[model samples]
Structures are given as structure tokens and as C-alpha cells.
Target chain A: MGQEILAIIVIMTAVTYGARVLPFLLFRNKRISGVLKSFIELVPVALLAALVIPELILTPTNEFTFINPFLLTGICTFIFARRVSNLFLVVLFGMVVYWGFDKII
Target chain B: MRVKGFIYGLRQSVTIGIGYAPVALTFGILSLKSGLNILETGLMSMLVFAGASQFITIQLIGQGATIWVIGITTLIVNLRHILMSFSMIRFFPGISLGKLSLLAQGITDETFVLNSKLLEEIPTPEERSNVALGVNIGAFVSWVFFSFLGAWFGNRLNINFSGFDFALLALFIVLTIGTVNRQNITTYIIAGLLAVIFKIIIPGKIYLLLSVALAAAIGAFLQQKQLKQNKCQGENS
Candidate 1:
């Protein structure tokens, strides 16, 4: 049992590190072209949107819902964040909103 | 100056470090309940150091999944890191592979978003690199420490983390709002829509990479065309 768990750990560490380090190794010290540079610049916005939206809308069971607490927290946080740039306050407001919504929903 | 940059990086990571606590604690508790001993749980957090992938791994282990199944799932889930690491290369050019590789290990989603935004505002490459290092190490310590703490107290504490999960999501929301601007607004919206569409159509987590690639491609194409049009109008006038 211990050996099997060890194998799993080793495999996960290898693949996770590989996924992260591959780009750095491949493109090290190379001059980035305009197209690739634009793509790179644009990726964070695109990827963050991709990461956030689905999680907001989908439940753990993969059911789509509009009335999610997390979704409400997100909208509230977005509005609050526009007025206030403090990360801690924005996140705290989000948590309060989420807790409130979770109670009702 | 380097120490200042590192200190600044650590300060920037406070929100992320705070956000990581409950989640990492939850991860540790879950791992303990899933039959992993304290040492194993600590090892997983210390070695893997990726959040979502680690959670997925613990879940898979609970379900009696095969080793290969878990490995593949982790690889797919973490493949997004490749895009992040690639994006970061533009900032740290001419740095050695050894230093860059160390930075690469710290490229989780939270730090990636934070550093990408902060790195651009800072002028010097050296300071940028130092800041990135500080953010990475700070977040790393929080995650590993909290995970081990959770495992250590898993059996003793019965705390519920119901609303705490929203903290990380809130950070993402705030950062995402910061990234939106006139230039990338279209891409951002399209990416969100495509993510929802593809999440339904596709299996596993590959939907993330696909939607990002397609949306960013469209954005880059539009941007280049606009640039060319401006140049042509200048020449004509």
C-alpha cells in the first residue's frame, strides 16, 4: 500500500513539474515574435475567464445553475472591486456576500 | 533593492496566502479522511504544490482509481500551467534555465495572475524576477504549511469550511476584473462563453485550454488587423 501510494506521488510530481517547466525549457532566452507575444499577452485574460466562468455557473454535480452563491458573490465582488482596489476588502466583501447567499439559497 | 523587491512580492502574496489557508486545510483533512497518513499528505502537498490538481488527486484516490488514471488526470488538469509558464517567459528573458525553472514550480493560477499583473508595472527585469520569486515562495509556504497543519489536526478538529471555498473564487474574480480593458474585452467575453459551451461539449478539463486558445487567437487576429489598418491610414493621409 505504501509503495503504491509512493508511485502515485512520484507520477504526479513528475507530470505536474513537467507541464509547468516544459515551456520555460523550450523557449528559454529566445526572442518572442509579435504573434506569439500577442498570444502570450492575451492568454491571461482569456485563460482566467475560461477558468472562472465555468466554475461560477456549474455545480459540483455539473448541473448548470443561475442562482449560485458563488456567482452572486462574484457579481457583488466585481461591483465592490470597481469602487475599492483593496484586495482584502474585495475578497472579504465577496465572502460576506457568499455566506449571506448561501444561507438563503 | 533585491531584498526590497522580494519583500514587496511577499506583501503582494498576502491575499493569496490568506486565501490558501482554508482550502489547503480542507485538502489536508480530505487526504487524511481518504486514508493517507500524515506524512503522505504532507509529501503530496510539498512535492506536487498545485492546488486543483492535488484536490482532484485526493478525490481520485478515494474512489480507488488506478495510478495511471490519476496521473493522466493530473497531467491534463495541470496542462494549463504550460500556457502560464509560456506567458511568463516574456518577462524573464535571458535568465538561466535554473533560475527560471525555480520560478516555474511556483506558477499556480493565483500567483500567475498576481505576478503577471504586478510584473508589468515594475520597470526592471531583475526586480520583476525577484518579485515573482517572493510571490511564489510566499504562496508555496502557506499552501504546504496549511496542508500539513490540516493533516496534523484532521482527526482532532471538526471545523466546517463551507463558505471558505469562496475566498479563492473571489480572488479570481477580482483579478479577472483587473485584466479586462478595451483591448481584450471581446476576447474575455468570448472566452467565458466558449468555456461554458465547451465545458458541456467536452470531457475532462481540456475544454479550458481549447476555449482559451480559440478566443485568444481571435483577439490577436483582430488586434493585428486594427494595427495594420491604422498604419495604412497613416500612409494614405
Candidate 2:
């Protein structure tokens, strides 16, 4: 068990690191074009949206709904975030809203 | 100057560090229950440093998955970092390979978003490096420290941390809002719709990568067309 666990740890560490570092090494010499750079710049926005939207909209059982606590908090946070740039405040607001919804539903 | 930049980066990391505490602690507790010893649990957090993948790793182990299965799952789960690393290159021109390799180790989803958004506000390559390093190290240190604490004392702790997971989602919502503008609003909306759609039809983490790729490509094409149209309008005028 000991040796096997150690091997698993090493493999996970190496594989995760390899996934992250491969791109930086691969693109070292290549000069990215303007069009490509614009596309790349948008990746972060796209990635973030893709990451949070589904989780907010979908329940654990994969049912989609708009009135759930998560999505409601998401809407509240979006409105609050638009007005407030401070992340701490936005998060606090979200928690408060989520907690409120949790109590009701 | 370097210290100042690093400190600035650390300051930026405080929110994320706070956000990571409950999740990392949870990871530690779960890893131990899944049959990993304290040392093994801590080592996994120290080395893997990826939150979701680490959780997935332990769960798979509990299910008696093969090492190859765990390895492949970890790879696919973390493949998003490749796109992140590619996007990060624009900020660190002329950075040494050694430093880039070290930096890549810290490129989790949260840190990637944080650095990408905040690095633009900073001027000078050196300051950017300092801030980026600060955020990464700060997040790493907090994650490891909490994981160790959880492994050591998690069973004794009585506090319920279920609510704090909202902090991460909250952080992402704010960052997503921060990145959206008239120019890229279409991109943002498209990405969100596609992600929800893909998660239904596609399995695993591949849907995330696919949504980002297709949405960004569509967004970029639209932006380029807009630019070209403006150019033609100017020429006609």
C-alpha cells in the first residue's frame, strides 16, 4: 500500500505539472499573430464564464432551474458586482443572499 | 522594489487565500478518510496543488481505480491549465525558462484568473513577475498550510464549512463581471450558454475546454469582422 500510494502521488504530480507546463514550452519560439492573440486574450473571460455559469444554473442532480439559491445568489452578485468592484464585499453579499435563500427554500 | 511588487501580489492573494481555506481543509479531511495517511495526504496537496483534481484523485483511489486511470483523469481534469498557460505568455515576455517552469506549477484556475486580470494593471515586467509570483506562492502556502492543519486536527474541529464554498463561486462571478465589457460581452454570454449546454451533452471536463475554444473562436471572428468593417467605413468616408 505504501509503495503503491507513493507511485500514485508521483504520477499525479508529474501529469498535472506536465499539462500546465506543456503550452509555455511549446510556444516558446513561435510569435503569435494578432488575430490569434486576440483570441487568446478572450480565453480567460470565456473560461471563467464557462466555469461558473453551469454550476450556478444546475442542481447537483443536473436539473436546471433559475430560482435555486445558487443562481439567485449569482444574479444578486452580478448586480452587486457591477456596482461594487471590491471582491470581498461582492462575496459577502453573495453569501448573505445565498444564506437567505437557503433559509427560505 | 521587488519586495514591494511581491507584497502587492501577496495583497492581491489574500481574498483567494481566504477562499481556499475551507476547501483545502475539506480536502485534507476527505483524503485521510479515503485511506491515505497524514503524510500522504499532505504530500498530495503539496505536490498536486490542484483542488478539484486532488479531490477527484482521492475519490478515485477510494473506488480502487488503477494508477493509470488516476493519471489520465488528472491529466484531462487539468488540461484547462494549458490554455491558461498559453494566455499567460503575453504578460511575461523575456521571462526565463526556469522561472516560467516554476510559475507554471502554481497556475490553478483561481490564480490564473486573478493574475490574468490583475497583471494588466501593473506596469513593468519585473513588477508583473513579482505580483504573479506573490499570488501563486501566497495561494500555494495557504493551501498547503490548511491541508496540513486539516489532516492533523480535522476530526476534532466541529465547525461546519459547507457555506464557505460559495466564496469560490462568488469570486469567479466577480472576476467574470470584471472582465466583461461591450467589446467582449458577446463572448462572455456565448461562453456561459455553451458551457451549460455542453455540460448536459458531453461528459467529464472536456466540455469546459470545448466551450471555451468554440466561444472564443466565435467571439474573435466577430471582433475581427467589426474591426474590418470600421476600417472600410473610414476608407469610404
Candidate 3:
């Protein structure tokens, strides 16, 4: 099992490293299309939302629960995230609120 | 010269390292509970450096999923990094292949975010590389140390936690605010709505990849049309 795990880790590392390095190699000294550039620019924000929101809003039970602690904390974070602009504070606020709520309830 | 780069990397890494330590520690503990040894847990965290994919892979491994399935799922989940890497290629001009490969191991969401913003501000290839190196090394060291700590103390630590998972949610909120602009607001909304709708309809983990792909395609098409119209209007004027 240990050897198998090691092999898997090695393979994964290779695959991931290749993925990260390929773009730099391919695009070296090449001008990419403006349309494609714009698309790539938009990807991070779109991907971040796609990665996070659905998971945060949806509970493990597969039901849309409005009073869900995660959702409430997310709301507070969204409200404060824009105003505060401090990652540490925003994360702290959300985590503390959510943790407190979970413990209290 | 190398000392400057290394020092910059160390400083950036410390900030990101602190953030990753707790998260990776949790992952280490979880992996240990799933039957991995401390070394394996630490190795996984050190090599993968992608928290989400690592979590999913470990969870699947715990359920006795085949290695092939885990590999395919991780590849699909990590496809976003392709785009990320593509966006960041401009910063790699003078970097050596050996250094680049080592740095690639540390490219996570946080490092990508920090480096991208840093590039925009600094605009110097060398400085950008320094920041990337610094941030990644910092995150990597943190991840490794915390992962081992978690694995070491897995049994002793008992904090029943529920709400800390929302950090990603808060992160997205912050990202959304930063990226919103006059031109991209419509595209952002369309993409966001599509993702939500797809989440509701889709059955499993594939929705993340599918929604993002579909929305990006649509957003790109609209942006192209908008650029064309603006170009034509300018020509006519």
C-alpha cells in the first residue's frame, strides 16, 4: 500500500507539474488572440465563484436551507468583504460568526 | 541576485504559509484518519499543494476508489490551473527551467492570486518571479509543516468545527468585488447565474467544471461581439 501510494504520488506530481509548466512553454514569445486573452482574464473570477458558491450555499442534505450557518456567514462575508477589503478580517469575521452560531445552536 | 529573489520569496511565503498551515494540518489529520501514515499525508500535501483536489482525492481513496478514477478526477478538477498557468506565462521569460519546475509545485489558488496582482503592480519579469517564488515557497513550507503536525497529533486534537469551511465563500466574495468592472459585470452575472443553475440541476461533482466551461464560452462569445461592435463604431466615427 505504501509503495502504491508513493507511485500514485509520483505520477500525480508529474502530471500536475507538467500542466503548470506547459502554458509557459507554449506561449513563450507568442502573441495570443485578444478574444482568448479576455476569456482567460475572466476565468479566475468565474472559476473562483463556480468553485466556492455552490459548495457554500448547498448543505450536505441537498436541501436549500435559508438559515444555514454557512449561508448566513457567507452573506456577512460578502457584505463585509466589499467594505473591508482585508482578507484576514473578512475570513475571521465569517469563521467566528459561523463557528459561534454552530456552537450556540 | 538570487539572494534577493529568495528573500522576497521567503517573505511572501510566510504570509501565505501561515494561511495554509491550518488548512493543510486539517488535511493531514483527515488523511491519517483515512489510513494514510504521517509520511504519506505530508508527502501528499507537499506534492499536490492543491487543497481541494487533495481533499477530494483522499476522500475517494478512503472509499476504496481505484487509482485510475482518482487520477482522472484530479485531472479534471485541476484543469482550471491550465488557464491560470496560461494567464501567468508572461512572468516566466527569464526564469530557468529548473527553478520554474520547482516553483510550479507551489502554485495554488492563493499564490496565483498574489502573483497575478503582484505582476500587474510590478510589471518587471524578475520581480514577478521573485514574488512568485517567495509566495509559493512560503505556502509550501507551511503546508508541509502543518500537515505533519496534523498527522502527528491527529488523535489528540478534537475541535468539532462546522463553519470554517466558509473561508472559500468569503474568498469568492472578495474576488468578485475585486474583479467586477463596467465591461465585465454583465459577463460576471451571466457566468454566476449559470453556475448556480447548473449546480441545482447537475447530479454530482462534474458541475463545477461544466458550469465554468459553459459560462466561460458564453462570456467569451459575448465579449467578442462587444469588441467587434466597438471596433466598427470607432471605424465609422
Candidate 4:
């Protein structure tokens, strides 16, 4: 079972690394348009939002809950993150608030 | 010059490495709890290195999904990195193909942001690549070490922590706030609203990719319009 899992990890890693590395190799000498370049630049931020919001909003039961502790903490974190540039403090604040809320309620 | 660039890169990498340790450690523990052995858990982190995708993959695997299903799901979840890699191509024009490929493998969200910002400060291609290499190696080392730490200490420690999952979400919120500027705020708002709306309507994992595409399209359209308007104003003036 462990070896099988290891095999799976190896396969997935190669696949993912290939996916990331192939593009750079293929497009190394090619010149892309400015418009396309701008569009690609927007991908990371959009992808980050997509990755984050759903997990925060959705309950384990699969129902959408807006007033959840996670969301509240996220909003607080977002606000603090804006005001504070330090990653450690921002994460610390969010974790404390989140843990406090979970314990209290 | 190469030595200096390498040193600077190493320093930046160490900072990112420290940042990634806790999260990867959590992933390691979660994988162990999911019935994976220490070796399997560490290999997963070392190989995949994608934080959210690995978490989701482990959760699915723990639920008894087949390997094929788990692999495909992880691939789809990590598809956004392909787009990220494309955006990063311009930064590595002068580097050798081998180094560029190695650097591309390390392009996580944190590394991408750090390298992009570093490029602004260090206009020289070598310096920028150094920062990218530094951040990547730092993150890679931290990920592997903490994951092992989590796996090794998994059985001994009973950490009954809840709400710690919000760390990633909180980090994203902080990053989003940091990245938004006056010109991009409108794009950000539109994307945020559209993502929430799609999350309501869409059924499953499709929402993740759909919202991203929609948001990027919206942002690109707005940016192009603004650029054209500026060009027109310049012509008229």
C-alpha cells in the first residue's frame, strides 16, 4: 500500500512538473502579444480568489453558509492584511480570532 | 555578480521557506491521519508541493477514492499554475533552458509574487532569476523538512486545533489586499462579486475554474478598454 501510494506521488509530481515546465520550454523563443500577456497577468489573482472563497463559504455538509466563523475571520483577516504588511502578524491575528471563535462558540 | 545574485536569491528563498513550513507540516499530519505512512506523506509533499491541491487530494484519498480519480482531480485543481507559468516566462529570457525549467517547477503563488516584486527592484535578468531560485529552493527545503517533522511527530502529538484551516484563506485575503491598486480595484471588485455569484450557481469543482476564467476575462476586458481610452485621449490631445 505504501509503495503504491509512493508510485502515485511520483506519477502526480512528474505530471504536474511536466505541465509547468513544458510551457516555458515550448514558448521560450516565442513572442506573445501584449494583450494576451496582460490577460495572463490577471490569471494568478483570479485563480487565488477562486481557490479561497469557495472553501471559506462552503460548509462540510455542502451547504452554503455566509455567516460562518471562517468567513468572519476571513473578513477580519482581509482587513488586517490590508493594513498590515507583515505576513506573520496577519496570519497570527487570523488564527487567534478563528481559534477563539471556535472555542467560544 | 553570479555569487551575489545567488546569495540574494538564497536569502529570499529562506524567507518563503519559513512561510511554507507550517502549512506543509499541517499537510503532512493530515496525510498521516489519512492512513498514509511517513514515507508516502513526505513524498506527496516533496513531489506535489501544491498546498491546497495536496490537502484536497488527501481528503479525497482518505474517503477511499481510486488513484486515477485522485490524480485527475489534483491535476485539474492545479491547472491554474499553467497560466501562472506562462506569465512568468518573460522573466527568464536570459537564463539557460535547464535553469529556467528548474525555476518554473518552483513557481508557487508565493514564489511568483516574490519573484515578480523582486524583478521590479532588480532589473537585471540574473538578479531576478537569483531571487526566483532563492525563493524556490527555500520553499522547497522548508516544505520537505516540516512535512517530515509533521509525519515523524504525528503519533506523539495530539493537537486538537480547529479553525487552523483558515490560515490559507487568511493569507489570500492579506495578499489580495496588498496586490490591489487604484487601477485594479474595479477589476478586483468585479471578480470578487462574480466569483461569489458563480459559487452560488455552479454545482461543484467547476466553479473554481469558471470563476477564475470569468474574473480574468472581466479584468482583461476592463484593462484593455482603459488602455484604449488612454491611447485615444493621447491621440486627441
Q: For every model shown, what is its TM-score relative to the native structure? A: 0.94, 0.94, 0.86, 0.82
| DockQ of all models, two decimals each | 0.71, 0.69, 0.54, 0.50
The runs of at least 3 residues in candidate 4 whose Cα sits more than 4 Å from the true structure, single-residue gaps closed, are A1-3, A55-67, A78-83, B1-23, B33-35, B59-66, B160-164, B197-206
Q: Which candidate is the best by lDDT?
A: 1
Give the lowest summed-lDDT range of ten residues in model 3 chain B. Answer: B163-172
For residues B127-218, what per-residue lDDT tens digits would candidate 4 score against the true structure?
77877787787778888888888888955756576645566566666667656677666656666666677767764454655666677777
Per-residue CA lDDT of candidate 4, range A1-105, in tens?
576677678767876787678778788857776567667667667766665666678776557788878888888888787778877677778878988777765
**A-chain TM-score of every model:** 0.89, 0.88, 0.83, 0.82
| Model 3, span B45-123: residue lDDT tens | 8777778778888888789888888787778767667777777776667666667666777777677765665566665
Task: Please identify which of the two predictions, 1 or 4, would achieve the higher lDDT against the true structure.
Answer: 1
lDDT of 2 by residue, B104-143 (tens): 9889888988898899898876688889999999999989
When summed lDDT is taken over every stretch of 10 residues in candidate 4 chain A, the lowest stretch is A47-56
The DockQ leader among the candidates is 1
Q: Tens digits of per-residue lDDT for model 1 on A1-105?
A: 489888999999999999889999898888987667778899989988988999889886677988888888888888899999988788787877888898898
CAPRI verdict (incorrect, acceptable, medium, high) for model 3? medium
Q: Which TM-score value belongs to model 1?
A: 0.94
Candidates by DockQ, descending order: 1, 2, 3, 4
lDDT of 1 by residue, B1-237 (tens): 989999999988888898899889889999989889889988999889998888888889999999999999998888888888999998997677888889988998889988888898998878899999999999999999999999999567766646676777888888887888999999999999999988888877778888988898888888888888999999999
Full-model lDDT for every candidate = 0.87, 0.86, 0.71, 0.73
Instruction: Please list the residue runs of candidate 3 whose C-alpha ends up more than 4 Å from where it truly belongs after superposition.
Output: B1-19, B91-94, B160-163, B200-204
lDDT of 1 at B206: 78
Residue B200 CA displacement from its true place in model 2, Å: 1.6
Give the worst 10-residue stretch by lDDT in candidate 3 chain A: A55-64
